[model samples]
Target: MSSATQRRVFLVAALLVAAVALGVISMGGIGENLVYFWTPAQVHENASKAVGATIRMGGVVQADSVDWQPDTQALTFTVGESAVDTATPITVHAQSAPPQMFREGIGVVVEGTMTDAGTFRADKVMVKHSNEYRAPTDGMAPADLYATVEEL
Candidate 1:
């Protein structure tokens, strides 16, 4: 082959290799940062896959299963798929204090990993609440919901 043609081939090959390397490096970074979100039922279903990885389980805190020990700063609760879901519930233990809005029948997203004991160990507990703001209906008018200079 001509020297010019050989140089062109070498340049094309290097570009291809650099592109593949860049793609692989980017994917590794993205995968490492990704934390999967699943429900209690999904966690059970994917037990083998969910173990020992940082997972965020989204579910409702079971009313009767909540046990908060302020003395120990440990909160344990069972999360179900939903308030009425009776089929599946997963126990979650958080060493940190529960959020102010964390309560029975409330939607929560617990970020942690599944243990061999079949319980989730949460490092962070996030309470899910409505984004839409609704004014109080207890004798409060629409204007009462907003702040005004007169009221201040």
Candidate 2:
């Protein structure tokens, strides 16, 4: 008895399979794989869709614009917006080997891609200390491996 044009083609194929299963369930929802660390004024306000994509900026490290050349391990710098204020800066350019708490104004994140002559060509630098676990007021537990504070 399925008359009326086969029940309107089975209700338009069940509303077109519920709109393609809600567009693939909103593409696996919930930020899919959240990992944003852009700063330095959000990478100069997304500098034209962030040059070539791969981002993760972050800031502070522009004191004398460090130029670590540990025998050519190469690692230029210049990522301000704090550390007494160097305003908007962003000249990363890393090649590797520079960690050991890296110095000058600290706080970095780097990651990569943004050249076109604007610099920030890192591959991955990340050096933002403070995991917090200070249980050594110096009674005899001296283990200060690269411990730094430079000023609270």
Candidate 3:
């Protein structure tokens, strides 16, 4: 092959190697920073691998499972599937006051790591709102729906 052709081939090969190296390094960083999103059921299924790994757990808060102490700002709650009784719930503990919209049966996503004791130590809690809006049903006025807001 001509010297010019050989030089071009070597340059192309070097560029390819550099591109591959950069891709691999970026992928490694992404893998380390990735936080998996899991439901309560999935978390239970992957309990062994999930322990101590940062994750985001999302599900509906179980009714009557929220316990918030104002004095200590400790909040503990259980998250489960749409039907709380259908699957085992994951316990989540956070050291901050929950959002005002936080309530039983609401969808929530907590970001944190799972403790060895199987509890999720949440550093951030986010309330998930429904995208679909429904009008008041029969016998319920629009004003009735706003009663809770009025009380607040």
Residues 13-70 of candidate 3 have per-residue lDDT tens digits of: 9999999999987876775456457888888888987788788999899988999999
After superposition, candidate 3 runs with Cα above 4 Å error: 1-36, 134-152
- TM-score to true structure, per model: 0.65, 0.28, 0.64
Q: Order the candidates by TM-score, highest first.
A: 1, 3, 2
Which runs of model 1 end up more than 4 angstroms from their true locations?
1-36, 137-152
**Residue 124 error for model 3, in Å?**
0.5
- Tens digits of per-residue lDDT for model 2, 14-87: 99999888877777563445646777777787798788988888878877878878788898988877775555
> What's the lDDT of the predicted structure labeled candidate 2?
0.79
Model 2 earns a TM-score of: 0.28
Candidate 1 global TM-score = 0.65
Which of the two candidates, 2 or 3, achieves a greater lDDT against the reference? 3
| Model 3, CA-based lDDT | 0.87
Error of 2 at 29 (Å): 2.0
What is the lDDT ranking, best to worst?
A: 1, 3, 2
